[model samples]
Target: MNNNTQTRTYAYVAAVLYAAIIGLSFLFVKMTVSVAHPIDVLAHRFALSLLVVSIPVIFGWIKIKLTLRDLWRIIPLGLLSPVLFFAFQAFGLVSSNSSEAGIIQAMAPVFTLVLASIFLKERTSIMQKLFLLLSVAGVVFIFLMKGSGMSAGNFKGIALLLLSTVCFAGYGVLARPLAQKYKPMELTWVTLMVGFVVFNAASLIRHVSNGTMMDYVKPLGDASYLGALAYLAILSTMFSTLLASYALTHLEASKMSVFSNLSTLISIAGGAWILHEPVHGYHFIGALLIIAGVLGTNMSGRKRGLVIPDKA
Candidate 1:
């Protein structure tokens, strides 16, 4: 096959990998955060990610030529993702339920679609738009079927969650060009470095102020916590970011964003298999909707006989 087709195929695979990693991350996050503060968990996760990515470069097995100027350009992408996205999500879930967070996150495609159109100059056919909405509707239906837990009248929580989606969307849009410009690992390295520095500094500040510096490393003593932290750092944060960057190199931001809905289905499956959560009838139905919507969104609208690319 041709290079473009080959690249496109790899892009979709990367998108799927990113989605699956992110989908399973909720499970891992639960494992890590149970024994440590959320901030501390984030700190450890990024610290590990940065260390892992930096090793290849330090060992002369990989090469990167990032200057201060490159960091300035890439910093916005970093801010949009691991830093702001996680912060809003951690705090947002504090006041809202999983169902609510699910519904809010499903709108990430809509956010990317709009941002890509305005900022990235990407276009979509009418059918693609409908399919996108259908996918979103599936996610909403699944979450709404989840029913009310504690009502969230807390405007703060809702706002933060919305901001989280926006940041992710913005990252997808902004990263598309940068992904094409830099090697995937280069972008992933910067992202991890920024997250590592920001989160660790924040954790350090919190510890200093509260005289809880001793408690920071206290979580590392647990074997389970260490396992969970490793998964999050190595797979979720580092590998997922690399996959996303690689996909963005060949896919449009708008197309890449829709794959996020697949994660909802993955999350459900993970819960059922690992957490022993019951798989309700609604889940099967919602899963069908999600799968159809994703397929349709990708397959239905092709101006030049090509579906757009999108992801987490």
Candidate 2:
């Protein structure tokens, strides 16, 4: 086959793989968080992923050729994405039901688009902007209409989730060019390591302050907890990261954002099966509208200013 045909084929494969990774995400999240605290789950998840990738570092399969200049970019990507993003997202998952959290997270692409416009100077079509707006409205609708057990106590969780989306969105936009420069595998290797340092340091602080690193370790005795942790660290973090990087190589940043719409569906199914969370009809409707908005935004491509690469 010609080069263009080969590239398009890889893009299609990447899209499917990206969707699968997202679909499986909530299941792993639910499994991991069940026995451990959210922070612990995130901390160990990154730590394990770091360990898994170390083989590449050791064998020179991947090179960490980062300069002081690259540090500026790498630091923010690490901080916003795997560090703050996972921290908040995990906290949000713990505080709220998965169903609600899933619905809320469906707005990530919309938020990403907004951040892309501000940070990356990415252009969005007018219709793309409108659909993105509509997607946000759908999220607000979920918050107001369906209810999220939103007390002052859980308000922080909701806010955190929203903030995490912004961080992730910004990362997506900024990382695109980086993805072009470094192969996704190489990029993930570096970024995941950066994230690991930040998260493990934070984990260290928390553990020391509490005088209780033992508590986090104790959960490893539980079979399910360990299994869940393995799934998340290996499958979700390592494998998914690799798959997503592959997809980003193949697809346009704007086009890839559309795959994030699948997360709500996956989360809903996962919530129902794993968390036993109820899925209200309104939730389904909201999800549908959100997906529609994502597709519309992509197809219209009219506004061209607000594109953020969506995540797996």
Each model's number of backbone clashes? 7, 11
Instruction: Give the top-scoring candidate (TM-score).
Output: 1
Tell me how candidate 1 scores on lDDT: 0.82
lDDT of 1 by residue, 1-312 (tens): 887778789988999888888777765665565688889999999999899999999999999998999989999899989999987876775665444555577689999999999987788889989999889888877767866554455567668878988998999999998997889999999888889989999999999999999999999999989998999999989999989998898888888889988877776777667656566788778878877878888777677734444332
Model number with the top lDDT: 1
How high is each candidate's TM-score?
0.92, 0.84
- List CA RMSD, all candidates: 2.8, 3.7
23: Cα error in model 2, Å: 4.8
Off by over 4 Å in 2: 5-9, 12-16, 60-72, 134-145, 250-252, 302-312
lDDT of 2 by residue, 43-136 (tens): 7888899899877778987777777787666666667667777777777766666655556666677766666667666787777778867765
CA lDDT, every model vs. true structure: 0.82, 0.69
lDDT of 2 at 235: 75
lDDT, residue 218, candidate 2: 79
Decoy 2 TM-score against native: 0.84
